[model samples]
Target: MEKVHFTEEKATMLATLYGRALDSREADPVLGDHAADEAVRQIDYDFAKLGITRDSAVSVVLRAKPIDEWAADYLRQHPDALVLHLGCGMDTRFQRLAPPETVHWYDVDYPEVVELREKLYAPAPNHTNIGTSVTDFGWLDQVPSDRPALIVAEGLTMYLTPEDGTELIRRLVAKFPSGELICDVFSKLGIKAQKLNTPVRRAKATLRWGIDDPHELERYGLDLMSSLDASHWSTPDVMARLRPFTRFQLRMLKYFPALARMANIVRYRF
Candidate 1:
């Protein structure tokens, strides 16, 4: 087994990876991520210590499904697009999407995370792993700007300070001529509540950026297209697979817009 020593924010990725693995083991799996399950089994770490439950595991997949569909849709339009999965932890999205060979995909993350990924996953055609901090602009030079870029930043924004996060988005927008960006963001209130989050608290990671308004990204040369509340992250099929209590909580989000908007998945075109 591969032993891990990730701490703070880096350690949090393991919790999410384990969450997906747990969901894959469910009777009615949300992600059905066998790869994640396999990766979890291969890694020597204390997953239970992260306190991820069945509901939270399902929540992880729910946040990812729509983003997967969006990425696939973008690929359909631009088969030769440059796909950038920023801060990609142990996510099997590249495997899940299975984009055409015409597309170039890059999984950008810390060097240590990429090293772990290399050990676990097989290399895919037209895919590259760049091991560097996403905030470091030097890595961007390695990515070709000729093609339209599809940027997917999930569970990553809040970890960055406003200056770093905003600059990252701006730099990405400036890199490509056209494409869409998909990301999930917590509201200011959600940032305040981060301490209460079990996995985050356990990992000892601090969340800094919270986007209360999706339109705020427009300054970075992105046009706001659409946004989905945590409520819309699920469908009937997904909800049916979840436990009753979790189902009830999700349903209640529709009645409380404030609570629902506390976390959202937003899409933007540049």
Candidate 2:
């Protein structure tokens, strides 16, 4: 393995991968991603440079879990759906979910990241890797539009300008006859606070978009189905199981409306 020279935006994928790998190693993991753990072992990068800690990794996994759950549910209903994983990075969601053979899965990302993924992971019969930016609509043409679809954009929206993100969603909704999208959004405060986010700063990436209300997406002609505050410390069951100090810190965020609104997981249907 050699040092990967990914651009700042592409490098952010390493942070998420590191987070998933960290969570996978926990005794009682929040979102165990053994594939991520394996990928981490295979990649030759300085994990320390990402500044990922146990606590931060937990946050990352927690935010991802809800989206995974939603996708799982969608797949159950439409096992043959097309799954478009935008900004796929080195994520192993397809391996984790293992949808039916009838399903077609496409992992879309920058060419370099896709190239790295091809080297790191084995190919699946129904899985296609699209080497292109998610903001580029041309990649969407490579996917079939005549089936139910599940589009996932994890840890990705904030990197796109609001107009670009909205346009992407609008295009997807209009392209497919019926489909669902699961993605995360940052609040105005969260975007501002990214300046202090260790992994983000280390990656030299800046947050570009935020939304106060999930309904704001309706402006793009999407039907906002639901949204959940996905802060790692916000879930009652997860919080109750944490150490007292951790619980206390999370409780403070939960009780404070402004802070609690920082991050959210939203689902939209077309």
Candidate 3:
């Protein structure tokens, strides 16, 4: 078994990884992320201590499904695209998508997280893992700027200060010839209410940036293509697969716009 030494913000990744594993074990799984299940089993850590619930696990998959679909769609359009998966927390999206060999995939995170990934996942033909904080500009130098890039930053933006997050978006948009940026964002209200979230609070991770308006990002050179609130992120068919309480919560998002828009999956094209 691989021993883990993650804590604080890093430990938050484990909680998400375990949540995906939990979803994979369900009778009618949302993500069916068997690779995550396999990774959880291989790690020598007590995931039970994280206090993640079944409903929350399903919620995790709900947020992830759209991002997965968007990434897959991008790959279909640009088979030779460059994928910059920022703050990738042991997600098997690259494996799940199985993009064409021409696609160059980069999985980036903190050095230790990347090292942990090296142990858990096998190397693929056109994949590379860069071990550095995503905010550190130097890592961008290693990636070629010649292709249509797809930058996916799931459950990542909220952790960055507004300056860092905005600058990151600007740098990414300016670097690629042209492509898309897909990321999930929490509203300012959501950031204030984050302490109520168990796994995040347990990990002692803090959220810094909260985007109330996605259009503001357009000023950085991106044009908003889609901004899906929590309730709309998943398709009707996928929504039907969720548990009752989870369904109720999503339904409430319609009645209460503020609650519904507490979080969103936004897509932008430069």
Candidate 4:
């Protein structure tokens, strides 16, 4: 295997077999992505480079399926809306959403990720891949200010300082008239605990923002929408369909969203 540089979440999600597992979601709704093929390749590259097996990644991704479904649902509501995937990495969301030809999609990222995306996954007619730092505003100018936007940042916030996260929201809201943003957050305490964990600490990746109060995002621009816990996916009917072990976790997830917060999904709108 070739030595490679793998981004943390990218490797983690891939290890979790995001798309294959997604295929198993009978009622889960998100447009599926064709680029999922390439994302798998990228994840394999990273896993080999990082010297870790794929097991842990599977656990994390399976635990976070609700977040993926949420992103897909947002795009369905605003099909013509501009879609920006910040710090996009290898996520195949645009290919999955496959927005209407009328919609404009921008995948913003560091040069390397963008290059990889371009080399591995071809963009659809409606899609545009921007190889630039999300902190830079170059791609925003490409979007029409008249239309609203749906911005999705899966695991990018943790890499940015709190001020940068706020500024990104501020600029995104200012540039797009009205829009929805869906992202995840760590509490400051959670961030610290992650730092102290030897394996994660060795990765040298920084965890930037933790929200004791997720509501603080409103100060930047977004309005809080409904908060979600895994229970949002469950019911007595679904419970009847699950295996004994699967049902056990969903039951735990319902009353125990906190346990699910080793990773989290938060939704917002501006």
Best by lDDT: 1
lDDT of each: 0.90, 0.87, 0.89, 0.63
Task: Report clash pairs, candidate 1.
Answer: none
Regions of model 3 farther than 4 Å from truth:
234-244
Please provide, for model 1 over 1-270, each residue's C-alpha lDDT reduced to its tens digit, 9 standing for 90 to 100: 999999888998998999899989988777788999999999999899998987777778888888888889899999989999998999999998989999999999999999999999999889999999999889999999989999998899999999999999889998998999999999998899998888999999999998899898899899988899887877797788778988999999999988888789888999
Give the count of colliding residue pairs in each prediction. 0, 0, 0, 4
Candidate 2: count the clashes.
Answer: 0
Tens-digit lDDT track of model 3 for 1-270: 999989877888899999999989988888899999999999999998888877678768888888999999989999989999999988888988888899999999999999999998999989999999999999999999999999999889999999999899889988999999999999998899988878889888898888888898899999999999877755576567668877777778888878767798999999
Q: Write the per-residue lDDT of candidate 2 for residues 13-59, one digit (tens) a residue.
A: 99999999988988878777999999999888898788887767767
Which ranges of candidate 2 are over 4 A from the true structure? 231-245
lDDT over C-alpha atoms for residue 156 of model 2: 92
lDDT of 3: 0.89
RMSD of each: 1.2, 1.7, 1.5, 4.6
TM-score, predicted candidate 3 vs. hidden true structure: 0.96
Ranking by TM-score: 1, 3, 2, 4
TM-score for each of the candidates: 0.96, 0.95, 0.96, 0.75
* TM-score between candidate 4 and the true structure: 0.75
Q: How well does candidate 3 score on lDDT at residue 243? A: 85
